[model samples]
Target: MFTKSILTAAALAVALPFAANANDGQAMQAATLNVDASAFTTNELAQIAAERGDTRKAERAARIQAQKTEVPGVTNAGRDMQAAILNLDPANFTTNELAQIDAETSALAKAERIEKILDEKSGATVSTSGVKSLTVEYVHHGRDDA
Candidate 1:
């Protein structure tokens, strides 16, 4: 409906200048159809109408053709769900730890694997003085189950 109105307004705008210059009295009478020239897209037309001291038409036309925008396919719910699924927090762990967690195939298996690792002995200390064998001290704050 709005599109048809715009097309009609455009066609009238195209023919208006010639119509205004006609010499016949009938043409002069036709010119007084009471339609304003500036009634096309954008607020520019409304601005023109206002400058010509027709505030009522300017406001009316402004309301009719106000700008509206929307993303083509993305709904608010879809966007929110995507955000929630991808929202991984890494504040408590290092990048290596995060990579280890990400390598798990399933959530239940991942949790079980982490639990088994945490249950093992970690951060065991050995005396370094006169030691023939090297003692590798592994400080495990969390699981290293990559």
Candidate 2:
């Protein structure tokens, strides 16, 4: 029993540094993301936001769902967001404040979409074709213009 225990400890000691070094090499490789919000319906935007762990987007998605026609997956995203937000501290925010946050969120989503396009065009390995459609829409509609 004593010899087996010693062998196990010795094997673990030898393996630990190699495992750690292997992880270090993996850490150097970057994974790319491509986002195209224009092609994404409101529900998709909400789903992306929720998957990315943005609680505010989830909450806003629920609100949008309430105001608009139902879409299949959006309700789930909204529910996830609501459940996450339930633990947050309650504070009364003015309508203007809420609007400002919503605007910021929308802008960030747009920026991410743009960034994805630029990154992919710049030779990012992860590619999604929706970015091209979004770029065209942005060019034509000028959705983000002040």
Candidate 3:
């Protein structure tokens, strides 16, 4: 009886740690599930989606979240300036030129500024298809451009 009791105690001692670890994992999973999806970065959302085996859905959710949470101080003037900056080829411009581009307020201004900078840098006149459409739309049947 004493031998059986000792064996049982040993088995319990070994099993307790495994049970505790399992509970810890479950608690962590619960905490993860409770977090706001909008707060997650794109990469983090992608990883979580990959873990859940639903890459497409996660990617779509991430895109939606990104659109909803526009970067601070960024504007959607003329085009998505943030996206344009992200897609811009850094190798094509010097640091000063890039900084100049970043300083521009509107997308149309940025494009025009970039063209001028490139022209000056290369010592060649770069023809820019400038401001294709009217940037401002006046409401209440009135318009003024001073």
Candidate 4:
């Protein structure tokens, strides 16, 4: 019984780290999903609602579209598009900055431009060292807009 107990403890010691890593991975994936969900543009939401036959979502998208209050110097459309692309809040950036990002034809280009703009604005390199890499999937809704 003592030998069996020691073996079980040893096995648990080996497995505990793996279990912890699995939990971390799951948490990261959940966070990524949340970002992706929130990154959907109003048009994208509308398209998704239509595809899923979800009237409530469709109506909500419509309401969001109708309720857009333009910021004083910000172009709402460009800001919103860049915000969705970067999985970031639109309020954090200015209209001109978002317009530059939106002008990028691809997601990767946009991300790079954002990083550059941030570096230029802050005068310091943004550190992403501790951030775990996540796969982002972008869905194009047959729009010319990136």
Candidate 5:
């Protein structure tokens, strides 16, 4: 009907301005992230990453990351770092780029050292009074070599 067509035209008029605004937002976002992709060659980044070494890179990363990482009531970064602190693969990230990522992922810097016990038992029984510690009795049923 003509009424339906008129209502549609009115609605489109109202939405057209919003659509233009949305396009403008996208343009602004693209401009914000317009990084020069060719600043460093792949080989240059790899060499820099290697020269930085794992320890220095991790330390730098931790410092940057520390800003974003809030002080949790209890965090064991030492243990986590021990496991996670490996030389970053040069293929994925450049040494020059760790600071930004660390800044964003700061929560990882405040990890505390943790103690881990790996006990394998054959026939083990454990009893706990509460959540703190467990009284464990491990029995090993092995062959009797007399």
Candidate 6:
């Protein structure tokens, strides 16, 4: 499960590349699970995942978690699904999390209309820890990383 940091790290490393390369202008499968991070809700998440053709186990679990938590719990559950498409790196996701992403996020959900971050200028590398910041240069064609 992705709740574990080590597993998530390993999974994401492998999933990111796949996701990044999967877009063939296929209308960019929207992240229906793409929460506002502010308005994300338990029932909404479960319903979205279900509409996206995800398994019942995923929706059930999310529902349960939502009922128990005060914040409706938002984890990187769909990291794998996203990685296999948007990230070009599967290692960026975990085993279970990937499943959740696939189960949740939908096409209409992705229709929230986000401003495009296109072109080389859209790429940025900023890593910060506490008051420390680290910079590294990497190439992102939005399709592949070099």
lDDT for residue 107 in candidate 3, whole number 0-100: 67
138, model 4: CA deviation in Å? 12
> Model 3, 1-146: lDDT tens per residue?
99999999999999999987764543454355443544654455544545553566556555545544544234444234433543454444444345567788776677777678657755776743322332423356555663
Model 3 bad stretches (over 4 Å): 1-86, 127-146
Q: Note the residue pairs that clash in candidate 1.
A: none
**Per-residue lDDT of 1-146 in model 5, one digit per residue for the tens?**
99999999999999999987764543443333332223333333333344455676445444434533433233344423432443222222222232333343333331110111011111253322111222234566897795
Best by lDDT: 4
Q: Which candidate is the best by TM-score?
A: 4
Per-residue lDDT of candidate 2, residues 17-96 (tens digit): 99877633223321111333333454445454555444654565555444444332233543334323422111222222
Model 6 scores a TM of 0.19
- Residues 1-146, candidate 1: write the lDDT tens digits: 99999999999999998787654433333243234343343333434345445566556455444322223223344333432342332222223333344466666554443344334312353322211232235466976795
Instruction: Report how far off residue 26 is in candidate 5 (Å).
Output: 2.6
In angstroms, the error of model 1 at 11 is 99
Q: How close is every model to the real structure, measured as TM-score?
A: 0.20, 0.21, 0.29, 0.32, 0.22, 0.19
Report the candidate with higher lDDT, 2 versus 5.
Answer: 2
lDDT-best of 1 and 6? 1
The lDDT for every candidate, in the order shown, is 0.42, 0.42, 0.54, 0.57, 0.37, 0.40
Runs in model 2 lying further than 4 Å from the true structure: 31-146
Off-target runs (Cα >4 Å) in candidate 6 are: 1-59, 62-81, 93-125, 128-146
* Per-model RMSD to reference: 27.4, 18.6, 19.0, 18.8, 19.3, 21.9
**Candidate 1 Cα errors over 4 Å, as ranges:** 1-89, 113-146
Q: Count the backbone clashes (under 3 Å) in each candidate.
A: 0, 0, 0, 0, 7, 37
